[model samples]
Target: METRIDEIGPGIYRLSTYVADIAPPAGFTFNQFLLLGDEPLLFHTGLRRMFPGIHAAMARVMDPARLRWITFGHVEADECGAMNEWLRVAPQAQVAHGRTGCFVSLNDLADRAPRPLADGETIDLGNGKRVSYLDTPHVPHGWEAGLFFEESSGTLLCGDLFTQLGNGSTLTDGDIVGPAIAAEDMFRSSSLNPNMGATIRRLADLQPQRLALMHGPSFEGDAAAALMALAADYDQRLKAA
Candidate 1:
């Protein structure tokens, strides 16, 4: 398995590793976003075993040890399994997440204490890169789930939201909503509830120019429409359930 690196946004890089064993014919891609600035931030750490490839991919763009902030959408293995490994390498790095995540999991999970941000709190990475954390508990699955919006690039580092089964392009102006719903039908990965659709709709308010997905290709072009379409699907699924 080789990890491919691509700059999806101005300074946001996607480090993706495709694993053929996960979903057979289509397979799956585990992606991690690297935001470069005065203080670089890495979103999603991939799996614990994926550290070497991910680290190597990260090194291609910038020194891995220069990473300052580590964060993810939730506490899943694929989301933050290599938390300690990262901290071990980047001595100055600290895991930052929503207050609920820190209070419930990251406080004890992280080697160094984490910085918990309130909803809507933004972290200035310098060079005009700023990320705001939004609490979205149980929207996809985890109770401490949250997402980040990079204000400068209008990019949303949305983890596991538009997950699909494929080793497609690093970035595309394609339809991700259909593939995502198909994957959801197969995996039943999302926590289906009344708030699921509403939570996703709230993200559409960001009007993100690009969506930095964790499993599938990074999407560009009419991201808000795609998000709204996905939300509508979730709402229909809830009614059908």
Candidate 2:
């Protein structure tokens, strides 16, 4: 497994690790988005087993221990698996999650106390970057799930929403929706929560230009339109289920 880091946006880097044949017919990627700000933030911790590679990737940008906030969209191996490892290395780093995630799981699992953000709350990331946490619990998977939108750069740190299945790229401006839908169909990983579609629609309101996904390329350009369309499709599928 090899890893690399790409600056997708100003002060925003996508650290990706790719492994071949992990998903049977295709390779897969585990990504972490790092926001370089007065208070540096790391989104998604890759997997617990991949800590070595993920940590090395962080070194390319700055010292891993300099991280101030470690956050995720949900409670999953690929989301917070290396949380404690990060807490160990970055002594000042605190786990940030939604209120539910903090109370239900993070409070108990995290090595340090978690900073719980309220729904629609904004955390100042310095350098004019403000991160808003959209509570999208059960829309994707975890009861504590949520996504981050960096206002300055319009980058939606959407974990596992538009996950593609292959040895992924660092970034893409094409129709990521098509491949993401196919991957969702094959994996059937989204939550069956009835409000899932509505949750997705909320993201459209943000009008994000870049969607930094967890398992694939960070989508660049017109993310709001793409997401709204996907929301409609998800509405139908979820209703059928």
Candidate 3:
């Protein structure tokens, strides 16, 4: 599997790897986002086995050792399986996540101590690139789940929010909510709690211009509307449940 790199937003690069064997027929894509700045940050470490390809893909744009912050949506293999690997390579990099994530897993899992972020906390990457973290406990899955929003580019580094199957375009303005719902039906990946819709609606309030998704193609244009639609779907699902 070859990892493809694309700049989904200003200073934000997406490294996508498509594996055909995972889901058969259509396959699945594991994506990671690299945000460059004075202090470069990498969201999602992919899998530990995928480090080589993702590392090479990242080196094409910037040195992997330059990474300053390592983070993910939650404590999952696909989300942060290569966390220690990254810390080993980028000596200066620290794992930053919500306080619960750090306390529950990262404190013992990380090779080095991690920096705990409070809800709505912002990390300045310098060069006008700032990312704010918001706790989204169990919205998607894990109690430690969270996401980041890049202020400068209006890009939301959404983790597993709009997860869809197949390796589609690197970026699209088309319908992602539909594909995401289909995937949700197939995998039942989300937590599906009453607060799920409300938490997602909170993200919609960000009015993100771009959504940097973890599983499928990154989306551009009318992100808030797409988010609302997804929220509505979750609400309906909760009612059905």
Candidate 4:
């Protein structure tokens, strides 16, 4: 698979999966990430089917076998389907889980130990770059979820948050590619599931500049305000209901 990579910010690139032709649901197609750091971190694996693209994208930064950490928010296939592959390629890479629950679940799946991460945990990516974990369980789906904010660049690696439909070339919230529409669609999808609103509240309080979605472009601007809008809107809906 020939993946299209776009540099969304310094050291960050949006990797477009070649499988868009197969028509995956929103937040389920590809991955957006930063790879030029000393110890690069990948937020999500596109899918089992997109491992080739994922692999190729990683190779662009270094040998696919050299990544130090493979971090993920959830245990879903789209988020972690390529775990075995990553373990195969990057033998020394540790699987970073947002919570102890996630570490246990993933251990059961891959028969490999996981590096448990909690809120406020920080992984040094070297060269003054580090990604801090912010636990936000059940935002889109519950199962030990969290977001990573790259301290050096101020980019929030939000998983399954601020996602949208369509496979566009540019990937960022400030790209005029439809942040409000995407935010509403994301709210609607997550609202159908219980417990996600709590995560939204946490995100509102933990503000970041960029909201990088796995399936679509990253959302930029005042992330705190954007997240507050989401949290407030969701709260109002629940009250009305």
Candidate 5:
């Protein structure tokens, strides 16, 4: 498993391509993000089976023990299945989730209770870095799904929004409309849940500078506009349906 880490913007970093293989849809190689704020936040931990790789990657960039928050869009195997492993490494780090996705406790995981994060909630990373969480109920495949947008860096840690058809290589969308169209088509054609359009509209209002989708490449610049365009497209598709 090869991991490539890149600094997308000031204090925003992405770890992509967990493995080189592309077979079986390669579900574990999803994008993992690290936000360098006062207390570093790890977003979207990989599958439980990849803990060794995940730990190695964290050690390469940061002291695995210093992670302060473990966050994800929803509770799933690829997204937060490594929470127990994370607690093993960073004993002090808190596992954050939305109200609807709350779990009582994983027996072997850390003793820290899950923190319920709500929509419009802002995580204040001291030294001027801050991220706001937007509740996206069905954008991905989770009922308690949500997206995180960093205010200072203009990066959105979108979960499974712009998933592409390839290994987790470097795939970024710079063109405003290209990725927007792709994401819109994907959700409308593939998604079975409602409220995606509404979620997109709310995300557009954030006006992010980067669209950091979990599955595919991260789109830089005018994240809000891109989200709005995708939302509008999905809205149209829904209307026609």
Candidate 6:
């Protein structure tokens, strides 16, 4: 397991861990995003077992204990499995997620209460950086699934939307659409929700410059066009299935 941290956006850092020889043929990558600001928010805590690595990675840049907000798109183990562990280290930090996630899981599981945000609510990270929450139910997987977009950086902290196979790289401008479609075919991780297309289009309309993914690598390119391509492919794939 090799863990590293790299700056993707201006002050946004991506903490990634690559696990070779996973069940999949291409291996896997677990990523977490840390944005430096007045409040200092961290998106996705990776798996609970990766806490030490994640902690060590953050220590290289900033104090992990000083993090104020621990947020995620959904309630999956890879997403919030380490919520309590993070709250244990950062006493001042609060668990944050979409209202659905908080009501469905975090309210009962988390050691600390969660700051639930409405569909369009925004959380100020200070230093002119703020995150606007988008309630994307079952777009990728979870019923409480949602995502966040940074206003200053135009980066969408999209969780599992464009999941690619293999531990590719830190970021890429090439075609991830093909790899993501292949993964979707193999894993069937995407949802069968009727509103899936609408949800995808919503994220595309945001016109994100960077996509902070959880699995595989991050992306820097025309997110809207990529999203549209995925949406169209997904529809065709679903029909074939």
**TM-scores for all predictions:** 0.99, 0.97, 0.99, 0.84, 0.84, 0.97
Over 4 Å off in model 5, which ranges?
18-29, 103-111, 167-194
For residue 151, model 6's alpha carbon misses the true position, in angstroms, by 1.0
Which digits, one per residue and each the tens of the lDDT, describe model 5 over residues 1-241? 6667777777677777544454344443477888876689989888887777767866787888988888888767888888878877887798777766664333224356777778888888776788787777767566777778888877888887755544534545565456436544644423544687777777777677787777677777667777777676667666778
Q: Residue 148 lDDT in model 1?
A: 98
The lDDT for every candidate, in the order shown, is 0.94, 0.89, 0.95, 0.69, 0.72, 0.88
lDDT by residue (tens digit), candidate 3, 21-42: 9887999999999999999999
lDDT of 5 at 69: 85
Please report the TM-score between candidate 6 and the true structure.
Answer: 0.97
- Candidate 3, residue 112: the lDDT equals 96
Off by over 4 Å in 2: none
Worst 10 residues of 5 by lDDT: 102-111
What is candidate 5's CA lDDT for residue 53?
76
Candidate 1 ranges with C-alpha deviation above 4 Å: none
lDDT of 1: 0.94
**Residue 237 error for model 4, in Å?**
3.3
List, residue by residue over 18-53, the lDDT tens digit for candidate 2: 888788778788889999998899999988898999
Q: Write the per-residue lDDT of candidate 4 for residues 1-241, one digit (tens) a residue.
A: 5676777778777777645444345333466475566777777766777788767866776676667788877778888888878888787787888665555587677646878887899999887788888876666555576778887677778777666566654644454324544555545655333455666767666657777778666667788777766666556656766
Task: Supply the TM-score for candidate 4.
Answer: 0.84
User: Cα-based RMSD of the predictions, in order?
Assistant: 0.7, 1.0, 0.6, 3.2, 3.3, 1.1
Q: How does residue 7 of candidate 5 score in lDDT?
A: 74
Better of 1 and 2 by TM-score: 1
